[model samples]
Target chain A: MDLAEVKRIGALARLDLGEEETAAMSDQLTRILDYVAQLEALDTTGVEPTTHPVTLGEAFRDDAVRPSLPTEAALANAPATDGASFIVPRIL
Target chain B: MAADSDLARLTLHEARDRVTAGEVTSAELTEACVARIEEVEGSVHAFAHRTTDEALAQAAARDAARPDPLPPLWGLPIAVKDNICTQGLPTTCGSKLLANFRPVYDSFVARRLEEAGAVILGKANMDEFAMGSSCENSALGPTHNPHDLERVPGGSSGGSAAAVAADECLAALGSDTGGSIRQPACFCGVVGLKPTYGRVSRNGLVAFASSLDQIGPLTKDARDAALLLGVIAGHDPDDSTSACQPVPNYEAALEAEVAGLTIGIPKEYFGGGLDPAVEEAVRAAIATYESLGATTVEVSLPHTEQAVATYYLVATAEASSNLGRFDGIRYGVRQEGKDLLDVYKRTREEGFGAEVKRRIMLGTFALSAGYYDAYYGKAMAVRTLIRNDFDAAFGQCDLLLTPTAPTPPFRLGEKLDDPLTMYLSDIFTIAVSLAGLPAVSFPTGTTAAGLPLGAQLIGRHFDEARLLAMVHAFEATGQGRPLPAL
Candidate 1:
């Protein structure tokens, strides 16, 4: 929960942080983790992790091609989109 | 015998009956809600987006086609939480990131409501990305409690609850990940039901924690809650997690008696951190239930202390994964940067608020290499134990009764600076969400300050019918549905 740790986690989460934010996050994350550290007191041995409360068997859809959103609708919310394609910063 | 002009005061069930009997037109009902919203929107700040024209048009259409058998929600003007997608309307989710983003299609819940002939009043404000306990986390602005203007309406569904309490709409939809709907309903003096997970489809809800988030109703009373739940609950092919079980007639289930029911009071919920007034009010509610011939017993949930920690881990981990879609590529606001990586980092950094960033960072750290087992994995295991605790308690009783929140609504910005203190606001309501059980928060009494106090009734999974029945029976005692003096 140090400044370096905060910065590393922020970067890993795809967020850019200022120096002050990083420092504040370090303290806050440390406190939260310290609180969370209480979980270590419990013995969770031989317990199965519950990912989702409702247990559903495998579901398969009919794999039918249905009507989808038109291209205009699909690109309606895009920040930067050509008529038929999205525009982004160059990769290489 | 409320007049057409006083349609806002009618419960969803009453309004539906009147509309079916031709006593009032949907246009008049929509006008009443619109006028109410116009009168109070300045103080309450409940709605993020108001759709007056669309609502009126929908109402006019409903009036034109007076079908033989009316739809369940016919002519009711209901507000939707901003996180649930609505076609052709801005679904901001109370964040700058999606400030003007309108979806191309309606969410499953919205579509069902529309098919049932409900008038879409507007989108209600909420915590940014449904993340905080108080509505103060909303980037647009915080919503004020209808009971007291200075105090906050609890969140992240604060606006929905406030609107229902203030009579801006007949009822509203709210998504609960961790007490978002129930706590706000408790604060605003309304009935909020969080149906069992997978009981309602989540096809288009903006995911915070997918497993824990279920859309439910915030209404003036328990019967209204049942009516709205019936309209929205059921399986959806679009949502794979939706249960394929037959949907029950929840409104009909409300007529059943609760004479022989056994309600458990979890001892842990009454301990430290509980305000005396809130505890006393909830205890009085339990006594009323006892007088109605329902038995009460003390139960234990030993892992209660670990729920907040486990919820944070599991919810944040899922949020981090789900929110990665908002990288400025497909939709939402984008900030141009030097490179693609820079675009993502800059967009997210500028778009998300502090609380969201803190959660994303925490999730990233927990799920990162070498730390997953110690943090996220352990949290999942502890979650099992927490669910087991509820199962064991329910085995002893039919329902668990407790205070919805540990305290009454505080002043705005009271706990905004301290994140841990804010997280503790969901202390009593989080375990039920983790267990994916059905629960409702109904008003028990008002505090000396006149703010509402609520008691929660938790039932076994998929047993919402019984829970609604118990709440309806309690409502018949004249203690439920206290309207704020707005």
Candidate 2:
């Protein structure tokens, strides 16, 4: 992968990188991608992919209203919180 | 309590028996562990965050209660991997992103430990976001191998295993996505088990790979592993993927007899990166089992060569998704930017370490438009073949034995520059994670240099009982469990 591709991935992944990091990431990602390329030699035709190890039936929980965490307690760890809401950068 | 109290070194079960017999109080045991931690923690660096006061208070409470028929883990101090959430305690995942973050509630495993009456010593260090095979990736700081100070304790569960080996805690909880538990347990000369996927709840674990992560025990021996596993294994309503299979009395399954049992030797696992010392130690284990009346059969996991590549694809892809929640919104360290999008980019940029960022970028690239099918999809398909290989092997033998890591404990900074080389460290342990089978690693012997050697025993899905039994059988001969001279 090239620096441009790495930049694209960084942006896609919401990671703002410095010039040095971008260049380093590009080189490392290239090597990793090339290493994983060994899989192309395998004939996996008609094989169903296993997304997860176990395929369990849907789980159901009781449909009863339970007391949830208090708003102050839930927001305790937030970097920026205004009592009940978590504050973040403006979207608009 | 003396700074070097031997009570701190007692195995989890031994401590439990003493506590139940009233020979020693929980407070004294807790003090012994605390004294031991104070003496060794500066050098070992095993804990990410120490809960000394909380542990003392918890231990005193256990002493005060003094209930008839004490609980199984009552008063035993155990270290938990930092990735698992503890109520109002720092669960950093060894990353700066969550450095100041604390879960408002306890994880399922934490709750189980609490109810089982076990005292939690602290949150143990790990590879940042549980990404690297060495603890060097931890943003907090690296944990050194207790066996040899200059060598690395394997990751991402390095701190957990080191804590157990150093006797900072009697046992520890470690989460394994790809050899995180077993590899370190091997390097540190302890017992580590990765239960079958869905065997343990993932409710409180900080996700690295949702499909692959499973929490298990790192302890002094197979009996401690079984006791700890029994407490943590079973279904949780909070975790939808947790299996509904009945939890067995794993401790009861520990027997010295290996008669009528068949163990598989996966030929693909031998040679190549396998160190001669590790191979010889593993071969000796096989011979010991043979003498105990077990038969050994040759088996093959032909797709073993592709496991690391597939694991990187699968684990990183899942990590990218799971970590997207770390955007500069609700919790953790955040950096301000012009807008919401810029905020996310900057917060993550400043928060994640080099290894965590690398995996994120790779995962995003793989899942990006046009590349998903080639990278992620192909990996999943290859993963199926890997699982099929295990299925075929299990069809021949009840268990599979191999080296936990290709080599013994490596020097700390040995593979830091080469990510591919670091990834290969988990080669023996990765495919088992991919197949979602249960496996355990116990010390086999130490090399000529005194570095520990570990052999793995893998069992069928949900067959942790048989797997622990086999390890116990060998352990009964006083064969493994080499104590680190640390």
Candidate 3:
């Protein structure tokens, strides 16, 4: 809940937090964590975590080549797209 | 027998019947709804985008194709939640990030509704990324309650509920992840149904918590909800979790008798946090059920108190992972930066609202290396116990009845500043979502202030038909309320 802790978490989440926003978040996260800390009192011995409500095995598609969204449609919503590909800042 | 001004007030089933019988044309219904929207949208602020020309054109197409056997929802104008993608309309999800983004493909629910001959009206407003309890979290601005402009319409599907309550649209599609649909319906005094997990396909819904989110209808009555659910529910190969179970004739199911049914009144739901008036109204609703020959029994969901904390942990953890896809590289608005990492950070910071950012940070903290087991891992285990609570309770009752929310809708901005207080509003409705059960919120009565109070009916998984039937019977008792004065 400290400023440094907020900064670390923001970095991990890839969010750029303002100083004011970070201060507010630190206080709020602390309050929320304290509230949720009640769960620590419960005994969850040997209980399986439920990732999802229903159990389903891996989904397999037909493996047939089907028509996909045309390149233009795929890139239609991109903010900066060259005609053929999304234009992102240099990664290297 | 009613004037065009009253056409917008007709339930979805009524409109469908009139259109199918040729007594009224889709153009007339569409024009009536358009006029209603025009009259109220300024105050209600329910829509993020309106599709007048497209709706009229679609209505015209339906009129021209009066096939021998008409579709179930022929010519009915329905609203879609902004979070659900529409092929040509802007699907903002009530965030600055996707404010101007339009999907190239319709979501599975939208596609199904279109194929069922429903005329798409527009996208209704919701909380940003369906993250908050009140519609106040919408980046566009909050949607006000139709009953009183000063009060908030409960959200993240607030606009959908408010629009239905105001008669701006016959019914609307809303997504519920931890009570988004039901809470708003309670506040707005309408019928909201969250079907079982995988009851409706989620292929086009903007993911919040992938496991908990489901598309549902906020309607004027249970019959309309059943009609809309029938049109939208079925197996979709596109959604891996969409169940392959045979879709029941929900409209037909509404005719079933309520006698000899066992209804459970959960002791936990009526405890300390519940408002006295809401408790009275909901208990009266149970009395009405009892008068109709239904048996009532007390049941306990011991883990009910932990639902909010558990929901935040599980939902935010999923949200953190799901929202990671919104980085500046692929879609929506992006802020340019010197480097890719800067682009990601700046775009997210600029695009997401405070609540969204708070959740992302909380989720990140939960899923962080040292804290994962204590928060996210423990929450998942608690979620299992919560689900098991419902399973055991259902063994004794056909349906579980409770108040939809702790209190009636409060004034706008009342709880906006405090996120925890806002989260507490959905305490009654969140557990059903966590258990992946189907539940409906219907107006049972109104508070002294004239705002509506709703009662919830939670059913076994995939038991929406039974839930709708019970609601229909309750509606048949001459207790179903009408639209609020705007």
Candidate 4:
């Protein structure tokens, strides 16, 4: 991975990394990517992917109403809140 | 005061008996720990937040009740990792982003401990979002290893393990995603158990890698691990991933016969880069098992080298997704911007530390449009082979034994700059997490320099009972490291 690629990835992740950080990430990510490239040597043909270690197929629960977090409590931590709703910057 | 100090040093199971017999008031024990924390926390930096006042109050209440048959965790003062939420206390995940965030509700694991009458001493420090092998990544500050203050208490569960080692808390709750709990326990010379992936609920363990993460116990001894695991391990409707299977009486299984057990020694684990002292201690541990009539066989994990590479991709991808919940508007410290996108970018940029940022970008790259198939998808497929290796090995042996870490506790800041080197520290412990098997790290012996060297015993899924029993049996042999003089 190059510095430009690292910067692009940072942008995709919604992170505004500094120039030095991008450079470091570029060097580190390149090493990590190169290391992981060893996996390509092995043919994983017909092998099923293991996403969840223990795949508990769809945990079901009763469709009954339970107490939910109060709006005030949820909004309490908001950086900008007007009692009920969180205030976010204007979006298009 | 001497009574308090003595009580502080007692292991969880030992203290439980004393408390049950009315030999020591919970107040005395709690005060002892509080005093100990006050004394050594200056050097160890084990806790992110201390709840001495709350813990004392809780202890007083437990003494007042003095039930006929005490609750399992009655009078036990324990620490919860900062990542696990506790309603009235802050849960930081050792990050600046959630540094001031007070959880409105308790995590499933925290609730279980409280329900069992355990007094939570505080939240332990960790690597930011449980991202690093050493606690140096914590925004709160690094946790110094109690044994050698200049060295790291292995992490991202470093504080939890350190607290238990220093007797600040009888035990602690730590989450393991690629050896976080066990490696630190090994470094701190304590017993740490990482239960099967779904064995314990992950309701509020701030997700780093959801697929690999499991909550476990870090305690002074194997029996304590069993006691703590029993309290926290069970199905919860709150966590869909929680196993519905019964939580076995881990304590009862302590007398499990190791005589007929077959322990596998992975040849790959005894390879290059493994410290000679670590290998000797681990080999001696195997001999000790042999003396108990347990036979050892060599097993191979052909995919061992690729495990770390595969883990970074899989874990980073999951982390990037999970961390999306930390956008500026909802909670935590946020940097304001002209618009929503700008706010997110600025908030995350300022909030996250170096290691966390590196991982987010790495993960984003893996899951990005053009790279997903090559990186993330390939990693998932390789993860299968890694898991399959364990399943095949378990076919021949009841458990697998390996050195918990390649080396003893390294000096603080030694591997800080090199992320790949830090990642390799968990080599002995990571594959077990990938396989979602139950494993425990217990002190085998110490290096000549007196640092802890641990042996890991990996077992089949939901086989924590047998794993703990074997660990208890090994600990019973009394060939272990002495406590660090904090």
What is each model's TM-score for chain A? 0.92, 0.89, 0.91, 0.92
lDDT of 1 by residue, B234-273 (tens): 9899999998878899989998878898999999999988
**How many angstroms is residue A80 displaced in model 2 relative to the true structure, after the best TM-score fit?**
0.8
How well does candidate 3 reproduce the true complex, by DockQ?
0.81
Clashing pairs in 1: none
TM-score of each: 0.99, 0.98, 0.99, 0.99
In model 3, pairs of residues that clash are none
What DockQ number belongs to candidate 1? 0.87
lDDT by residue (tens digit), candidate 3, B1-486? 567679999999999888877899888888889999999899999987899999999999988997778888888898999999899889999999998799999999988888888898899999999988779999899999999899999999999999899998889999999999999999999999999999999999999999999999999999999999998999888899988889999999998988899999999998897899999999899999999899999999999999999999999999999999999777888998989999999999999999999999999999999999999999999999999999899899999999999988999989988988999999998989988899999998788888988999999889999999998999998878556777
Which residues of candidate 2, in runs, are more than 4 Å off?
Answer: B1-4
User: How does model 3 fare in lDDT?
Assistant: 0.92
Fraction of true contacts retained by every candidate, in order, equals 0.87, 0.93, 0.78, 0.90
Model 1 stretches astray by more than 4 angstroms: B1-5
User: Which of candidates 1 and 3 is the stronger one according to DockQ?
Assistant: 1
Angstrom error of the Cα, residue B298, model 4: value is 0.9
Clashes of each: 0, 0, 0, 0
